[model samples]
Target: MNNLEESKTFVASLESLEPMRDFVSQTGSNAGLNKKQIYGLCIAVDEIATNIILYGYQNSGIDNGLINIHTIFEKENFTVILEDSSTPFNPLETKIPDENELGLPLEERKIGGLGILMAKESVDEFRYEYKDGKNFNIFSVRPNDD
Candidate 1:
């Protein structure tokens, strides 16, 4: 199998969705990720990117900003890092649904808080931080050791 390490950065706009997906697909392929692993990585990244486009620069009315994506492929693990220079907001801070609360009516429990939760469950590790007026989210996954 071939292995590669690469990184790319793009403007934080709706148009960036395709490029982001392509980057992830390429990185996942190089890291020898199977279909399921690739899809999970792409979905998690999409959720975070969508959050940035929707809320990150909304307050300042900024048209374009940087959304940096860096990927590293080692012999055993894959790591993806996304960084954006917008308002400091970490999705990890949001509350996740509880199993007991699942029995409650959907409307009565909460309005919207599922994307991040799903992303969290799908990945092996999800971490976030805010620094220098930027939000950094790091996601890591280890393929099944067969």
Candidate 2:
């Protein structure tokens, strides 16, 4: 982690998603990531953020929950860290939908894991942790050489 100064907090709700995306986009741009890389980072962060907002806060009946987003610039990678005060559920513990499961019809397939799979695929690194009463989702990606 090089620059840890870029950080922001958002209300954990559907309404905050756009700003979350914008923050990721701007941070990626500032870190010299290409458009596609930026898009991937945005999608990865947005998917996890949505889950945190919905399952972690809204469904859990936790009013006024907040998510703190932090960006770190390293020599070879950009990192986005999202911390939320939701219940301790490790998304990584959930089974990632495999190809066979994904091939099933939409109605037959399970719903919960696809977003997590997409979020993982869209980034070079994805990690989750629950510590000190906070859930942390971390995303990292490398900038391709021009």
Candidate 3:
């Protein structure tokens, strides 16, 4: 368990994803997660962040919104928090895509929910909340040594 909580704020854009990924990698390593765990954390965060960048800003009248990523490294658990200034969205409430839809190619498949489904599947816990006009997604991962 580490006392330090690592956090970073970035403009919601594809370019900021690399920095977020690096932060998750370093934070996961510091939290004693294995490579595979760290990779999953990265993918989960990336998927959600991509949605924020792509859709969160739509119709919000904001050209460039901001997002914050925070990491909590506790004993046997690592949590990532993503906060965005975009409109209210409760991603956890979304319906999980059917496996048949997941198997289809991108062009043939439905547009929404698939990414969030992947993000939710990659972590031990996935939660979403809306507060004070901000969207917060909390993801927790616990690595198993066995």
Candidate 4:
């Protein structure tokens, strides 16, 4: 099992995302994930963390917030837990349109929601929780090409 505790990363700007991605890529590799899994995990992490840093913290009058990431690898699952000290908002709560919006042209489709949808779709399991004044995004991949 791959387990990491208290792997805290502090970021006040988008500039920090590179290092975070590097860390996640390394962690995923160390956890024995395949290329597809590593790429999927990284993409999910990047999308969600970018939103948290850009909108939740930067635009919400917060100069900086701490982001702690924990990874858990079981026999058949790989999990990445992200905790952030931002305003209580759940990205998963975003409403996805019933229709297939991606098929629509950029001019015809409604704005926003594409990124969240991609992030959610990239993983086998994605959950969100807001507790103790912190926001949590749990992303996981199961056995077989998740």
Poorest lDDT segment (10 consecutive residues) of candidate 2: 1-10
TM-score of each: 0.85, 0.91, 0.86, 0.88
Model 1 global lDDT (CA atoms, 0 to 1): 0.81
Candidate 4 residue lDDT tens string, 1-146: 54543365757467877877787788778777788888878888888888888888888888757677787777777888888987777888888654677778778988687778888888888999888888889999864563
Q: Which stretches of candidate 4 lie over 4 Å from their true place?
A: 1-6, 143-146
| TM-score between model 3 and native | 0.86
TM-score top scorer: 2
- Candidate 1 residue lDDT tens string, 10-117: 888878888898899888877777887777788788888888887887556877677999898776778888999887888988887778666798677874667787
Q: Write the per-residue lDDT of candidate 3 for residues 1-146, one digit (tens) a residue.
A: 34658888888888989998998899878878888778878888999888788778745666778889999876667899999988787778878788888888988988777778878777888888888878999998885552
Winner by lDDT: 2
Each model's C-alpha lDDT? Answer: 0.81, 0.88, 0.83, 0.79
Candidate 2: regions farther than 4 A off? 1-4, 105-107
Q: What's the number of clashes in each of the models?
A: 0, 0, 0, 0
Identify the superior model by TM-score, candidate 2 or candidate 3: 2
lDDT, candidate 2, 68-91, per-residue tens: 999988788789999999988788
Query: Which of the predicted structures, 1 or 2, would earn the higher lDDT when compared with the native?
Result: 2
Could you give me the TM-score of model 4 versus the true structure?
A: 0.88
